[model samples]
Target: MKIPKIDKTILVHLALFAVALIYGANYTIAKEVMPLYISPSATILMRVLGAAILFWILVGKKRLILSNKREKIILLLSAIFGVVVNQLLFFEGLARTTPINAALIMTTTPLLVLMVSAITGGEKFTFFKIIGISLGLLGAAMLIGSKTVSDSSLPFSFVFDFNLGDLLILLNAVSYAIYLVIAKPLLKKYSALSISKWMFTLALPFVLPFGFSDLGTTNFEQIPTEIYVGLGYIVLFTTFLTYLLNAWALKSVSSSVVGIYIYLQPVLATFIAVALDKDSLTPTKLIWAACIFLGVFLVSRK
Candidate 1:
């Protein structure tokens, strides 16, 4: 008797699906814990530190060694874009903005990745890509209308306004896009666990300064159990599992395929949010979702 072997392509798709599922649910789960049970920055600190320890324990020291200065530099920069700026801005932004907005804005990542790759000479630009980018930006702007946290009644307004959190999430998308491009070569050379652990370890110094004070302020005992559960999800599933899965998938597929999966988050997030009563779906949200999906489809199209 013997166990049957699984297909690598199936495994990659499963990994990507798991990543999208974790992240889509994370939009609301993480939002529930931040700026209330714990500050956003402190949450980042916890997430990075916890994932780093887990990666180290899981991967061991053998794969952690680097062969060259260039790899070290790339890891450092990846830590900045991938861990520090990416996590910091996203958590902080989610603390202040709606989960739906975060989900919608994040649909731009595949387009951003394409643009970054083109600028870096890794890919060529085309008119269709330009149109896709424009559509994504338009959808984002529509979602950011003059609706404040207090203005819950105006769920789908189209008036122009700025939400700092939405803007930060946008920047987070850009940072993550840069990380994807910079870390592609590294992923091919190193085990995903090894790269992930090192990136989180290097991200510590930069993350600590921002999150340190908030870390001390969180009274863990007083927080509710659900918040802790949310925290654990962010630390374990969203941070560790998702990164490992993405890195594994990257080894088997193009980064563009990886980026395309981001479109799943909004759809999944919306369902989770609506089901949990954490958020609602409106006509405008549906319309924008369609626009975003179309844009991402064009960007990922050959």
Candidate 2:
């Protein structure tokens, strides 16, 4: 069957939009399942394994070649940074922080990637990009501030007042930025699905220990069936489908455009949080959302 021609830009944007929506909803989904059936490590492991299996099934008989020792080494390292470490930090951070904070901090990944690229001579740092990144940070700060002010019912004491969840999400952003930079060169040689498969397979070993430990603490028999179903959804949609679509989008569109989509994540996440989880959509959130969106636009614009 012949494939129909599609506008690459439109397809990329659409895919990115879908990814943002799935990612946004994931915050609540993960929160619900993470505490019951899985630990951070286990959740990460399931994601990688599930995604890899799906990729392998789709790729069929076309053998993905590693080429040489150097390529294999690079792939290994890419898996370590991109899949293993990045996911480990992300899930653990999610466990500590609220989804809103996590989503907000994740907006920094693009700026961080740009900085890494500039320092490595992969890309030049432009003034506009700097301004854009600053805008993103300002937006995130506004959102954080709004969240802080709105939740006045809680105690003001330092120990009890602050949410550790946001900090964890920030770590995921940093790790993800590092992964993007490290994985860029490899993408030139391998297809995104191929790269994803190898990375996840290699990451499996590293993540397994954590997954097993989390399982030990939980009573598997006592957990509700819905929690497993939620886990399945996360693995299928958030982990597997989202990653594949993102990889395809990256291949088809400019990285700057792809980066801009990060802003969409928090917006979608907030809506999902409100609609499904019954989280408040406060004025403070709106303010922060504006700041973040402005920052993303500035950073990613030509």
lDDT of each: 0.87, 0.73
Off by over 4 Å in 1: 1-3, 145-157
Query: Could you give the C-alpha RMSD of every candidate to the true structure, in order shown?
Result: 2.7, 3.7
lDDT of 1 by residue, 1-302 (tens): 99999999999998998898999999999988988789998999999999999988998876577889999899999999999999999998898888888998898899889988999999997888888877877777666654433346765455567789988988899999999998999999888888988999999889999989999988989999889888999999999999999988888888888888888888899889889999887777677767777888777777
Candidate 2 local lDDT, 15-58, one digit each (tens): 99998888888887898888556777777877888888887897
Q: Compared to the true structure, candidate 2 yields what TM-score? A: 0.85
Question: What TM-score would you give candidate 1 relative to the actual structure?
Answer: 0.94
Cα-based TM-score, every candidate: 0.94, 0.85
The local lDDT score (0 to 100) that residue 174 gets in candidate 1 is 91
